[model samples]
Target: MGALALLAGCGLPRSGPTRGEIFNGSVLREGDAFVLVVTDRVNAIASVAPALGFSSEFRDAGLVGSDIISPGDVLGLTIWENVSDGLLVPTGQNATVLEEVQVDGQGFIYVPYAGRIRAAGNTPERVRQIITDRLGDQTPDPQVQVRRVAGDGATVSVVGAVGAQGIYAIERPTRTLSQMLARAGGVAVDPEIARVTVTRGGHTGSVWFEDLYEPGHDIALRNNDRVIVEADTRAFTAIGATGAQSRVNFESQSISAIEAIAQVGGLNPSLADPEGVFVLRNEPEEIAEQLTGQDLVGTQRIVYLLDLTRPNGLFFARDFAVRDGDTIYVTEAPFTRINKAVSALTGTLGGVNAVSSAAQQIAGN
Candidate 1:
């Protein structure tokens, strides 16, 4: 019987989350800062703050900056004149100057009578002051007002195996990358963290979600930006005496052998040959060819193996992460295969004897 057929006979159910869940959960709660820092040794700018309970007005303390601006933003402006009632009244019957006016490609907004005004790099209050100064001669004591239509235009892309994979818009001016991910829905049940790429201006960049929980390692976002959450579609082939021997979907870019086994509910306790377990990967020649063609090898296209019986194997199990398109084979013990063959032969001999005896009795009658 084929490996798949053998697996079907075992009646194994679906697999669930394992240690990978802890990493993914951490990413959703904190961010990708720590993971990046550990893997690449890069420094992040933002710091993680304690969660403020039941305080709606308190913004995430991680957000820092005196006055910063981004592109593709909108603003609302209201001009008022002092009134006898002590409440600010509209300068004219129509007090609103601009409503939801978008910033231009050059990061400038065209104001009425004020001509082209730079708004991209300036704060809302500063922009209002600039406009007020420009119109000082036209009105006597003109009170100007300005506010962001959409604040802190940092965005992160969500691609791959997700319910919704695309660019998610973030309105928090000081929100970190980790905060942006929560806004985009946490990683799917089977997440490939290594395959998760963060690109800036069409160039590849890295973010450390783990560091977000640490003191200082969170990075801020910019407007018109993108965050792609992609599902790692890599296929991992499982062979040998496992419960279900078939190709399992690896949601993340890297998966250790132990984790892979757990994903398939570990080796079937009754049938698995723990000592002979092996993972067959692409040959070095094959990898070199694939990489030369498109540079898709290296971390993204490597495979590994694990032996559960060895005590020290656990260390390698965690460190030897699997790459996309990896194959894991668990060889059955010699006795198991021999026993199956002997049982089949015995059953065949019994069936033949019964047929011969029945034929002779019919002929004699």
Candidate 2:
């Protein structure tokens, strides 16, 4: 029995004290709910201050305001003349007044009478005024109008774990980040909420989904902007005597080992060795070896064992957070494994006898 217990312990996972686990136990034991310390390094970036901007306090950058018009936008212009019968007439002999104009690569639109006029970066009303002024000498009371035709100039690219991934044209000038996501068909049906990354010119910025959804925290989209919705790459594998031995996606930045087990529907009570729960983590050297394919000298594998038999262990379970791709395994009790082995041996013998009898009958026939 002693030898069996030793084998069970060795086979079981190893658990060690974590920084947060130690801190929690120490601080809570002192009966202090609040603790403050002045340090040069602060975690202010994760916290968001709505009054200032939509960006988190920890983020060095601010939220993008609104999208502006750029060059190469197709604009539709129509000139109408008030006629005698309250009907608008085209100034041209063809009786066609409306003319669709394209803003050139240099942000200039050409009119019939007026030469190349710059319309890009100007509002519709501003463009209309500029057109009116330019054609003042040609016709009396020249009424010019300008409207956006093609939206190629103002576009946002949506990529990553969304239903649709591509560059979307922003019909409206003032398009928000949330609206752009909706146009991209939303995020995947996973715990990982979509992260929006906006790249403009050569500068890039990122914002979390929660920040965009929460009230008073709205980020604007810009023209010629690129929004990449990256897929959730991090995952946690739950194995051993769990209800479901599967890999659960690590959506949040942090997750406890117990929570990871619960994600797979917890451990199988009948076969689980509560005292032998273990978490297998790849050491830094192992990860480096796997990544670079070079043999790492003195590489050590890390295995954390947790004994869930004690009530105090529950506190550690909450504090011991698991990293992405970490494996959570609840080992089967020694007795259970023995029983399974015996059953497998018996089943194998019975199957062999049945096969042998069938072979003999065939040979006799």
Candidate 3:
């Protein structure tokens, strides 16, 4: 008993929050700042949900043709005059050979009789009309054909962790973000855990690869749009009496607390306190009071308690969003500690009794 008492009192205490302290609602400290916000599903989602905000480059704009031309593109122009004595061509020549014309920096292409026409910001068909209209006065009803020789001006760049990384020309009528990704051989990592970012004009938005298949996810790509697929390294740490205590990477974009608990090996039946499943997180100081009643001063470490003993606790765990860098802890139950102490005492007494019995037998012998 004495040895057990000494053993229990000595050594270091458990390096984690207790069930009682967290259930009572308290603030965890770190350095000299208040950052934790332990709360229920409503508060937790509100506090950390904003980080998931991704502004999409493709908004409600429906699918659009990718035939919009830009400067530096090469255009093939062929002019055909029905009359044998064409004014634009020679007296005997009825057609002009295909002319390879490069759209200048000013978005203009020069033609023999059409003069310099705006072709950079217009589609190939639109440029053909412009050339035909210009040559109408020179030649009687000139039939003009404009073909895109090379796609050097308008292209979508696919960079980052993908099988094929390069600029893909958007020559189709409607080129979608998914099409560009497919052109790049999809993402190198798993689609569920990968993040795809689309930058168009001045707006940029990101979505998980799993969301790429969702409705409205296959947005149309614009000229000069950049699609970057990056590996998702976001993760959360699980400690205490869970199944396994270690950092677990986010297999998906987001996971519920119930799934997170299962990933950490679930609660340890022998040592976990059913009423003290806690999630520790750091939140913005502005919404601290609204989240929890605890008057947190520094390191606003919030300890959210989930009582698995209650009927609604397990149900609500599914709604809780496990944020990145969150700490999922299952505190040790009170009886668990008592059992350890009692087992030590029982072993010590059993050894003493065995020795005494051996001595008595030896004396009799």
Candidate 4:
């Protein structure tokens, strides 16, 4: 009888610790975690400030003239003179073509008798005027035309989650963020959830792909600018007695707690505790301070509770904002453990009755 009692009362297997077990271990005994009841008031508060944008330094670097020349740019020069025998013109041809003149490291280019002329920081037309003035003393009635033949000038690299990754020249069409992304063949990921980041000098700025056309986000491209297109990586983990235990990625710019639950197929109907839905995350100090009404330093571990059995519970969950790196857990129902215990007890009783019957049969034989 004692052995049977021990066998029947043994602990049953559970997917995870129940709600009471977690509260007793972390809240009541350890006192390391704080539990906040999820309500309309709590849902209204922003858990933590999001880092979803760029600073003024990036926004202030607005649009600039896209045709300005830079060092290392390849210039194409075609020179024509009125006289057939005039200088810079070929003997048989009426014009002289300098197909590939490279801008020197010091922002100057040598043009035969024109000597070292400044080309960088000047438009192609401005450089043409400078060359025409320089050659007028030697060549009579000189006509000069200059155009950027190949991009070595102001260029930005487009990489990460784009259709084609390469160095693109910051030309007139590809001067802004949206234009540049189009020049790079658009983002490989969905534009709604994609992110575009521009890193210039020591400062880095980012904005959503869909927001790149917004006023301040469509900043001008600069020399050596690195533009990266990527998808949103923020996600929350769904565990415990929910339909599935998996890390679910954020589907949009923002996700509500109820939506997160639905992503993991919602709570398991048979085993889930309707009153034990919890979201665990390290909340910022300001929020923790507001909840506890105390001065707290650094981030605090918070376990937010949501009871779906209440009248306003679903509405509160709908309003709750689920943040990145949060863990949503749904505990098993209390009666599940009781059912497991009763099932074990019934099996034990059946075995005992069978054994007693066999013993009686043997004694009678």
Candidate 5:
């Protein structure tokens, strides 16, 4: 009875989850709130992906036409008339020069004979036509020319992690995003880990520098657009039985779980349980709903399980997208903890034997 009681009392150490027990099919069936997935190449990639769509920020950047003028733009006007002693247009002088007429806060420019003309929101060419029409009868065949000298409205400010940081004027009708970055003295951060942000009209959007390598990603820039280039803060943590338990910054925006694991020095071969590979992430409510077939309220902290012992495990790992702030954990093998406990017990027993032997020798003396 005593022996049976001893065995029964030490039935199990309900400490933490064992290697076999965690991330298994049974966990999903147990009606646990957390989501567990058997990662497949197709589904793994689909799981971490947020519904990505083309940005509307630079939609009009592709539009070909004259650059539109805005408030705070400096305009230079030159007027010429055939008749002598003209009121607004000088005949004796080559042209009546109105150098640096800054566009007002109300988006209007003061012309000598044309009164306050709506110059903002219209191209320089459009403004010239409006002014010429207004002063047609007053001056004989009035020839007007409009030029942009210096203006905050016709320029963009490039700030953060750049060689040169200042307002860059759009001298030409259109400047591509790449061209603007080059003019601003290129990006300071590694191109792979850099993120470019554009803010305009109270709306903002960002894209990784790696995206610029694509054909159409190098979109054009508009007047008064604020472009910021900064180092990417997105990172993932590798913990547990992995070779290195540290935070790893993404070199590129999208990296497969396989690449991430490799970058962190693949799992500890001796200690890691191949079946216990897991990724913990706070999944968005929408994603949780799609995975579990139920609407998840608030932040759904989901744990994704990957069985690397399976045949297609490597392929799944390659396809799985590791997201920012994700925790990649490779649980220790069952035997590893048991071996450690045994070693501690052996060391304790050896110390006790050495003490007993020394005491026996002293008693004999």
Candidate 6:
């Protein structure tokens, strides 16, 4: 009995440290800065639940019109007159073809005789009417036709983590966020963890790439809008008595504590203590004040304790949210140490018995 007790006290093979040992190691030089919190309904309510969403301006922005022209657009104009000697065209030509007429930066396009006219804010049909009216007195019943050529006037820049990066025009088919992304050859990273950010006129909004197709998320695009697709960088460290001990990236936009544990293959069933699942994080000063009664100077070192034996323990875990950079540690069961010690002692006794039997046989011989 004494030998077994001594073996257990000296230290036996363990998957991880015990709950009491973890608490003992948490002490700091300044004081007991580590605040241990019991996971409950009250604490779960105060836990951080972070999510990405767009504001009203991002969601309520109007769609870009299909036929609208901008300053950087290219226009093709064909002019015809009733008489043989047309005003803008040559006498023998009957009709004049003006190819690749680029609209200037100030929204003006200079026709040969029509002078500078605004074409940026008007549709191709509207520009045609304006040009016909401009030559009405001199040309006598002039017929003008305006055709829009390819240009970057109403284009949005698609860059970062996409299969292809370029400036894509916001046509009728590619007016929404999802359509624009598809036009850019789609995201290169995993859709489960990809993030899409839209920056328009200095206003920025973001959403999970998986949620882009959802309702109210596929927002309308605008001219010169910058669409950036980036892979999620949020992750947490899993250590101690869990199945895996590595940094697990967030597989979804939001994950609860229970889901995070399952991502790491759950706690080690044979060695884990049901009541010793812990999450270690440095809580912000404001949030720490809410959790603890003290107004901390900087980030407070928090150790959130989760006891799975209680009636509402599972519910608490389901409600508690796990943030990025958090370290999830599960302590070993108390009896696991004693069991390992007993196994070691049993093996030692068996070896001793075998040696003694061999000595007796040799002596008898």
Q: State which candidate has the highest lDDT.
A: 4
TM-score of 4: 0.81
Better of 5 and 6 by TM-score: 5
TM-score of each: 0.51, 0.52, 0.73, 0.81, 0.81, 0.74
User: What tens digits encode model 4's per-residue C-alpha lDDT throughout 88-161?
Assistant: 78788899899999988888999988999998878898999998998899978799999998765678999999
lDDT value, residue 250 of candidate 2 = 73
Q: Which residues of candidate 4, in runs, are more than 4 Å off? A: 1-10, 25-29, 47-51, 76-100, 105-118, 128-146, 353-365
Model 6 residue 47 distance off true place after TM-score fit, in angstroms: 4.4
lDDT score, residue 259, model 4?
94
Cα-based lDDT for every prediction = 0.54, 0.61, 0.74, 0.85, 0.75, 0.83
Stretches of candidate 5 above 4 Å error? Answer: 1-17, 20-37, 41-48, 51-54, 61-70, 78-86, 89-100, 145-149, 213-216
Clashing residue pairs in candidate 6 are: none
**How close to the true structure is residue 166 of candidate 3, measured as C-alpha lDDT?**
92
Per-residue lDDT of model 3, residues 1-365, tens digit only? 57656655554245366665564453242233333323354545433565432454365655545677788888887788988888566677767766578888888878876788888757888888888888898778899888888765468899999999998877673278777788789899987778898887788888877676777667777778888899887889999988899999998877988899998789888888878887777766655656655565544655666777777778667777888888888888876666667776787789999999999999999
List, residue by residue over 1-365, the lDDT tens digit for candidate 2. Answer: 45444443343342232323323433235422211121112112111121222344324333333333468767777765444321334434323354557777887877776778777666677778887786666555667667777655566788887778888766553377778787778776452445567776776666666566777556656667777766545788887788888878876756776788888888787878777676655456544344335577554344555667766666556566677667776767657755555555567689999999999999999
For residue 354, give model 5's deviation from the true position in Å: 2.5
> What is the alpha-carbon lDDT of model 6 when measured against the actual structure?
0.83
RMSD of each: 13.7, 11.7, 5.5, 4.2, 4.4, 4.7
Candidate 3, poorest ten consecutive residues by summed lDDT: 29-38
Ranking of predictions according to lDDT: 4, 6, 5, 3, 2, 1
Candidate 5 C-alpha lDDT tens digits along 1-365: 45434432343332335545453424356534474655563364345565222376575555423467889888999988777788775556757898889999989999987899998878889999998898887877889999988764467899998889999776563376777888888899888778888887777777776677577677777777899999988899998778788999988868877888898889888778888888877777777676666666876767777778888887777778888888888887776666555555667689999999999999999
The 10-residue segment of model 4 with minimum total lDDT is: 1-10
Candidate 2: pairs in clash: 13-305, 14-304, 14-305, 15-304, 15-305, 45-58, 159-229, 160-229
What lDDT does candidate 2 reach at residue 92? 40
